[model samples]
Target: MKIDVEHVTKIYKDTKALDDVSFTLSEPKIYGLLGRNGAGKTTFMEILSGHILASDGEVLIDGENPFDNQRLTESICLIKEGDNFKKDLKIKNVLRIYAYFYPTWDQELADELIREYNLNPNAKVKALSKGMASALGIIVGLASKAPITIFDEPYIGLDAAARKTFYDILLEEYQAEQRTIIFSTHLIDEVSLMFEEVLILQDGKLVMQQQADALRDNAYAVSGATKDVETFIEDKEVIQSKQLAGMMTAYVYGNMEQAKSAGLTAEGIPIQELMIYLTENKGA
Candidate 1:
């Protein structure tokens, strides 16, 4: 399931949610769609999921347009943030409906997750707690077994333990059943390791897309005497810099070997911190 987004754009009155965004994602890998709030992450997901049409350009799934294409839509499952079901439906009923719609849905997996999460299948969706609701959504998303599974901040209200469970289960499922997973979330550090590739969006534009390991290797925190640190990054892209007392730490984006030769102590920067620096300061 290869997704090719070409020159896609979305306009909402005065706001340009997506500005000519483009990317190509090959199948059977986890992709992290990362960005700050209102950076077009959600918009991109919506377009790909066939929930919204792009104002310009196109989005294709294996060379076919996905918007309103039932065949394509059936193969792509998007777990958005917040409630997506009718309030009156019971938890079990919701899963049953989804199972009917998605031909590839695994009932056995769904049953296992239902038991693991301890969800009351008889309980109405409106009566469930936030965490329980999120768990249910995750179960549906994973059990659907769509070729392209997208989770947009799926653990919004989950606790640490519950989130860990979700991550573990997701990975296990992925290994057992190869699929394309696009995870968009602000919890970058928590899920960074699971991503094979990362796509970064900034202010409605696609800024960077690279292998997760390569991106992490390129991002580093270099610190030394203020003068030496500044000199070390003279011509490089410095994402962030701060002075604590007389010492300064600069987060520079480039090859680590370049900084090592300059005698600067380079430390790995957390993906979350890197995202903040890139999106907050316009890749400063």
Candidate 2:
């Protein structure tokens, strides 16, 4: 399935959540949707799932608009941190209700996830801790097997071990299903490897979208003597710079070898650092 956002914009009273954002996903791949607080990441996903109408422009799934269309809406599953389940309902009942809603829901997968997450079917939703609630969302998202499965910061309150478990399960599920997966999270460095393509939004706009490896290759970090670093980045575009006691590290966007040739040590910048540099003050 393909998703195309053409001149998409979302406004809420005095604020514009999305400012004519535009992009396209031409194939089924893992996409990392990234942005800072109130940067329109959630709003963008809402538009894709047809949960809310865009203020202007359109979002198309395979050449057709998804607004109020049950066929397309059902095919896209958007899971978030706080999935509103009936507080008094037991875990089993919750899964049963979800099974009825999603045509492609897998009973076996649901059962497996319950055991994997160590969730009791008899326990009411209100009794579970925050992490357990996140686990339930993960189960529904993976077991639904929708063509476009979206996870928006779905692991809140999850410990490191539990978060790692979720990531492993997600990769395994995607491998077996071969569906379009959209994962939005602030933990970029840990989950960056999970993405084939990365889309970054800043201040309600699509700033950058590129293949993960290709994007990394286009940026580098230079460090050494302050004078040497400054000389190395004299003509290049410096995304970010920090100085302390005559030592400087400047994250620059350009050829990696160019900095190395100028007698400065070059290191690979992680996705999180790249994001910070790109959206620090004056955004990319």
Candidate 3:
């Protein structure tokens, strides 16, 4: 279930969604695909799931190309943003149809999830509330039991409680099934602990890919007097900085020891906040 993206690129008319991005993923691990809006995270997932073709280069699953390949498609389920289910179909009917299509579909899991989420199977897809619709999508994705499950913002309309439930259920299923999960999300802090590795995209390009813990350790936020912060960061790679009321906080992308020596209080920055800072000050 390893995924390999080599020099992959995608262009839409006047815009380039992906710019020769490349990465490799081993199976049986949770990966966090992180980025700001319009960072090509969605485009990368779409190419991997065979929903869209890469404008250049290749996307492969276990050495085989996944584009339009039925065998590979059946083993990879992608729950993308927005409602993709047929509006005319009932929730029960949709589940039934999916069960028939995927040989590895788990009926028991689907049934349990439906009840746990308090969803009415008889309700038409279009009739369900936004939260319920997202819940249904989650059920289908997990029950499909696809070896490679890619979830792109699957908790869009879910409340905080419901979203926590989804994460808990996902962890339970992954531990029991040992499947590869690629989660693309903006709620980085909520799900950061679950990710073994992280892939960060910036403006259609791969900015960084590394072990989650290692990446966090490599970067930090240092705060002190405005002048002190400036002097401290003079020789370092300051990813971002903010000053207010004579105090300054700067995100320095380097070793903590260096920051401490410069008389700055270096603290770990949460993944979500770090991403926002990075994407916002990408040019700085």
Candidate 4:
């Protein structure tokens, strides 16, 4: 499924949720939607999911608008943060309801996941804990088998072990059925490995959209004697740097295939650290 967002902008009474944001998702792969708090991530997700409209520009899912369109919306499953299920509905009934709406829903997978996540089918939706609720939402999302599945911080209440289980299950599901997955979360270091592409938003604008591998390939940290480190990074775009006494460390982005500076220690920058630097030093 190809989802094209063109010059999208959203404005509130005095706040601009998004400012001329644009991107194209032409393939079925995992994309990490990253940014700091209130970086227009949720706003953009709402627009793409058809829960809200862009004040300007358009979002096209398979060359068609998804706003209130059952055909397009059915192909997309958005598992929002926190619990939003009916208190009266049992866990089993909730899955049944989801099955009714999602045409590609898999009952077998749902049942299996419910057991795997230790969620009781007879328990009421409101009776479950926050972590259980998140687990149920995750189960629904993975079981939906929608062409486009979005999980907007769906693991807020989950612990490290449970989160790991979710990630493993999600990767397995995606491998079985290659579908577009847009995942947004602040736990970048933990899940960055699952992303094929990373999109960073800042203050209502899309700051960067790059492949995960490309970002790592281009980003590196060099440390050595101040003179050597500076000389080695002189021709590169340094995102962040620091020095103490005679030692200097520079975070750079560029081709370093032939960079053979003696006494310099070069290391690949982690995605999470790079993201923090990018957001902290905007427009640098």
TM-score of 3: 0.92
C-alpha positional error of residue 253 in candidate 4 after TM-score superposition, expressed in Å: 1.1
Q: State the lDDT of candidate 3 residue by residue for 30-105, as single tens digits.
A: 9999998999998888889888899999999999888889999999888877676999999999999999878899
TM accuracy, model 4: 0.95
Q: Write the per-residue lDDT of candidate 1 for residues 52-111, one digit (tens) a residue.
A: 999999999899998879999999899988877888999989999999989999999999
| Model 1 global lDDT (CA atoms, 0 to 1) | 0.90
Candidate 1: the clashing residue pairs are none
Question: Local error of candidate 4 at 111, Å?
Answer: 0.2
After aligning candidate 1 to the native by TM-score, how far in Å is the CA of 219 from where it should be?
1.2
Q: What TM-score number comes out for model 2?
A: 0.93
Query: Cα deviation in Å at residue 142, candidate 1?
Result: 0.6
lDDT of 3 at 146: 92
- TM-scores for candidates 1 onward, in order: 0.95, 0.93, 0.92, 0.95
By TM-score, is 1 or 3 better? Answer: 1
Q: Candidate 2 lDDT, tens digit per residue, 1-284?
A: 99999999999999999999999999989999998988899999999998999999999999988889999988998988795588999999999988988899999989998999999999999999999999999999999899999999998888999999989988998888789999999999889999999998988998889899887887888999999898888898878888999999998878899888888889888888788777766635
Candidate 3 clash pair list: none
TM-score of 1: 0.95
